[model samples]
Target chain A: MIAEKLVQTYKVSFDQNNQELALAGSMRPQRAAEMADCVKLLETSLASIRGTFYVNVKRLVRLNNVAFHSLAGALLKAAEERPDIKITIITSSVIGWSTKKFGTLTAKNPKIVVEEYDSEFYPGQAFLEEGGFVPVLRTQTKLTWKHERAILPRHGLEPGMTMADICCGIGDFAVLVAKEFSPSRIVALDHSKSSLAYARQVASEFDIGGIEYIYGDAAEMLLEDGQFDFVSCRHALQIFNKPEMIVNELVRICKPGGRVYVTNEKISQCLGEPRGPSIEWTYEQLSKLFADFDMDLEFGPKSYQALQRAGLEDLRIESFMVTNRDGDAQAFADMIMAWEEMFAGGMSEKRGDDAAFVEKFRRGFEDHIAAALHPGGYAGWPVWVASGRKPR
Target chain B: MDLGAGQTEAGEFTLLLEFDMDMAGFTSNWSYCDRLSTYFARMISHNRSDSLLYSNLFSSALNELLETVYRLHAPTGSFVCSVSRNGAKDRIALTIPVDTETEGFYRDAVVVLNGGDVSPRYHNALFSDGPLQPNIGLLELAVDYAACFSIEPADGNAIRLIAELTLEASAP
Candidate 1:
């Protein structure tokens, strides 16, 4: 059986690594049998439709890692036994090699392959390997932490204050607010289930209380009227298809004397020139949309007269530049390499030889990351962190 | 259950039961209430079961008391009630009325109701001998009587009753 073959190979190659000669020299019949047994166990377990089993094993030969093969084979066996059980195999480094060497096990049952990846390439693949949860991105982590630090002073967050966080991706900021402010209740709303799952996991791991994770589109979530002392969003307003509807929802949930904080990164400039036309067009549309809701937008020094025109009281705007200088140069190189891979993928798909475009993007991204880390890059790609407060 | 009228400076005031009496009867009749009391006593004597039912019944009673306050207080114009569940206890604290006359009435009623099963806790101090000075301590007594009236059935009827009560109280 394929399951037996997988276990035999797994036992034999358990300690095998990248060295081809060592792997060739270590191959033995007895070791193969042990690997087969391991595969059999996995296959048998998967064949049963009851419980869920997860195994983490590393140090398999690059091409024929038995753990990956056994998991794949077991998934196939499980599907054959009962097609309803959901099986997810998340590999970080060797998935591509396994798929290529073993042939696609998910071909017969496409749904069984929830996702497959090589973690070394997909930085986000770290999430799947770590039980399908990833720590918030470092930049996002810092942003959230800074927002937490600014909450009490900027928004007057205090214990027993009811608060709502809209577009709360993974609820990192929401968890911080729940823990630090000890709000009477903190409703963390997100549109993505994956994000909400991570948020729930973080809340559970930290034993943070008084936070309710709500899943749905933020604009459509039926929030209780006048229930929150403050409604907040972090760096999510721009991506909202209907920014105006979201703004209105924020205001609707806020109490009569409550405040609404909209935190967003404004891309006003690109590549040391005025931002691309597309970016400006998007913002203009956004400005017009918000105007319909009587919101006064305060963009950097070129503050819109519409803010005053909309009769917004206490309108304020601030800008800050974030740079990643403390990290090693290799990190910058790795980032550049990742972007190169992305460009390569797109270029390859189009069958176009755009090596010059690839080089330009690589150089730009590398310089940007490096400069931002260096004092010289501080002014480049400056992020506008602006917030406005709604009147009581 | 009848809640007796009490003398207040404003005038005579009466306590009204807000839940559907007919629904309460359908769930727990008077005879079944006696049976529950007997079974509970026996169960306690034998140590055969945990007192989860007692705890659940107490929680249900408290929820009902708060729900009544949330509904009637606003309508009567005495005080406002905002029912929030994320707090430590299932209870309602009436925001103190600014008017001295109204505050006096509310405080006296709460003081009288202190230490009862549904004891009233005053948000503000009460004036002695005020027009609203009917002992709210009686409110707690009323809850106890209502708790005793709750009956248990052979099936999962008690759980269903609690669910129904919770739904009624939490309905916006």
Candidate 2:
């Protein structure tokens, strides 16, 4: 029953995304009869969906048995009545009670199932999510921060602005921003729970507040709309299969006139003085190998086009080369060495590259590291930084 | 199900919140159960290991208890809701005006909750073909939240119902 003002207390929407019906907010109806409208809507929606109907309770923060029994009971009836359809309830682990409570419905029938969202949230980023890669991620952030700290101001980051670091690997950049520019709030989101846990631990160690490390998928983020003044997604777009989708999200969450900043790599453009030819061959091979996995290693220069397609205004596009000559030569070399280990020892193996190809790949990284450590040699990893303001 | 049981020691827990208002004003709208529980959950969950997760879990548990009282209690008297903490545990204490029928309902539900596992009962009640169970909230707190329930006589005709839980993944 709709109240006089509005029953804005909760919402149930038939998303039509993967046949998902999203339920959110506090749904504490007094009795089962009070949920008649919801039950009717759900039943009607079920008729049109495919063989599998998904109930996305990931954002459903609160639900009483009266409401649950009604909605879930309707799903159960659909399961028995329409045997062709499999009813799946998607619960978020973030809400502790969701999985356990919704899981009970599966017992009634095998066709009804409850699956937690976090387990499969991150797709195509498994190489970066390995436990060993965590330390390397921090080292990468440390090396990149030297360039970004200076580059951020030109991209429209200002003091007290609210920012979101999408795909915030380990969240060190967010901490850096919070300490330097003093954002009123920073929502640092990454898909890996392990990465987020480490980020929280680091923030706690630094005794810095205001950085909210959240676990989320960048493609279909749970973050609300137009809630941020500046949105910086660093070194992330290239990793995702669809960079434009993420750019659109960055624009969606940015307030009008607020800027969306991004950083991505042009892998083949990564240059080194010593063993230049070998490094070039390896990086070019690396770019193709990444393409095999749906990741875009050469998405740096394409950042301009991605933002433009997303319909952002006042585009500012530039590139920064994090070279060994800039700050810490050893640190930069350390980052290159870690990348070699991951690319050769980990991702290359997953790609089923032959011993000769992997050996050749390892040689290029070693040469880049050699260039970084060489006294007179120069090694550079170029990152493209781009920003566009959401039109007012 | 935390009504008419036994008293918790005064100094054993540190009080966090105390909201008092007339019962008629509180029960005038069913939405108050949701509003008050959410407000209390946010107020107390800031220091938890995962504040958003803790608040979401706590608000659900507290809303069930408040809804139970809203359904079964007398029409008039002061309603008191208090939250307290001792180490990792949080206690939601609701002192509500009760009639003989409502008093018996709480006492009986507590007995059923203590005698056996409430999970099967909760599921059965959840999907039962008959009319909805009035004590579903009690079984929910006991089973889903793993909350421990207790009750003691409060001032005048009121009974103090308490549900204590360790909702945090770890201490703050």
Candidate 3:
């Protein structure tokens, strides 16, 4: 049954691509018709299979508006023909530029939700509204590829590994791990309800299984003792007003001999100076809380410090540089937009002018990217990923 | 051209200026430099046998000594006046200026007598032809000097020697 479904899915995708090619002026009518017929046969055979087919038709709209429409028509036809097989399509709303007939499908599949996500192509709400469909798809594709490449390392993940992603922001890493590592289970936990909701939608649309989306304070949620083999908290550790408590919680969830991985941008390095309350001050305050626990804390270079005082043992520190690059002008613009939002949102609670701060941040990002793109721009933002084990 | 060829005995002469006055009240009214100056002028005026040049030298030395004393002790509203006699042959003078701002007990005044080429004994006693004796009469002289002379107050000011005289005199 899985094979049959796979064949049907492959045929549908081929037909969609062929239709897109013909409309893009790259395929003749005869070739397009032949691919269409193949799609029909597979659709007929796989009509009984239960699953959802997700396609980002908006991506095609940029290469050829005609092809995008054609593919959209084919997807709608397939969905209508196979009532048993649920189909959903997602696209950035910026692509709303196409024929009005596209939006007409919103009524056909109430299960088919159209969400306008913050895409790598167009990061901010404004660009996501103005840049149209192609940039959005390009951004999403770039981001997806980035996350995939970053999390795919065998050393970072493995099968049957149980991991917890705190502040999993749209589950980019969560989905990557789920798709690539085939982990036994992952709890993609976040404090934002909306973020988690979108993450769930994306997971379902991509048919990513084994990921449990949970919304709440990850630190507050109690886990069954020694349940997880590995626990990870990334990017979100800096947001916690009380990061030590969160760290303690991460340690608590992992079984003896289980690894706890935590990663965050050392803001001090990124900003070139300490901007807020000192990390050392916070660490010292938190270390007292974990004095009773037997663990070694090791701090990696570039502001990655292990909490040695916390009794965390066998600490290992590693460093990585995260660069956001898009190949073209629109892609770059979209990236700037997204980062502006992130900066504005992240820094809004602190003192100072939020707009100015975001502008400065955007400029810094561009400067960094320009340097990195050149032969000698080795200066990239550093991310510290450190891990420690709970003594058996 | 007789230079005391005939034996004519000159009677021993002592000049004493006496006044009935309150010591504390006079010191309170006068500055240390003023007292020193008065004593210097009186010593120069009374010693007629000394040359005008030697008298000036004595006054200048007294003034310098007063400045030095003011620098060291800086007594409040007090002064020192001294005179030296080289066995009735040579005269030396000294003075000390004090600051009214300093608070302390004013001790007894000292007088050092030294002879130049006139008296070998005077030189031997002072060890350097400078005065080495303390005299109670100089203390009286200091009080009389304070009573008779006008000196700008040393009040936190730099001490200075206002006069000097360089004179060579043979034994008289």
Give the candidate number with the greatest lDDT. Answer: 2
Tell me model 1's lDDT, rounded to 2 decimals: 0.40
lDDT of 1 at A88: 44
Work out the TM-score per prediction. 0.41, 0.87, 0.36
Candidate whose TM-score is highest: 2
- Candidate 2 local lDDT, A233-330, one digit each (tens): 98889988878788888889899989999988989988899889998998998898889888899999999989988989899999988899987899
DockQ of each: 0.01, 0.32, 0.00
- How far residue B70's Cα lies from its native spot in candidate 2, in Å, is 2.6
Best by DockQ: 2
lDDT of 3 by residue, B1-172 (tens): 0011122222232222212122233344323333433344333333332222233333333433343343344443333232323233322222223443322212212212211122233222222222222221222122212111212233343222111122223101
Residues B4-120 of candidate 2: C-alpha lDDT, one tens digit per residue: 223345468878877887888888888878877877776787566555567778988998898888888988898998888887998888898998988888888888888879888
When sorted by lDDT, best at the front, the candidate numbers are: 2, 3, 1
lDDT of each: 0.40, 0.83, 0.41
At residue A35, give the lDDT of candidate 3. Answer: 47
Overlapping backbone residue pairs in candidate 3 total 21
- For DockQ, candidate 1 versus 3, the one ahead is 1
Lowest-sum lDDT 10-residue window in model 2 chain B:
B1-10
Model 3 chain A worst lDDT window (10 residues):
A1-10
Instruction: Assign candidate 1 its CAPRI class.
Output: incorrect
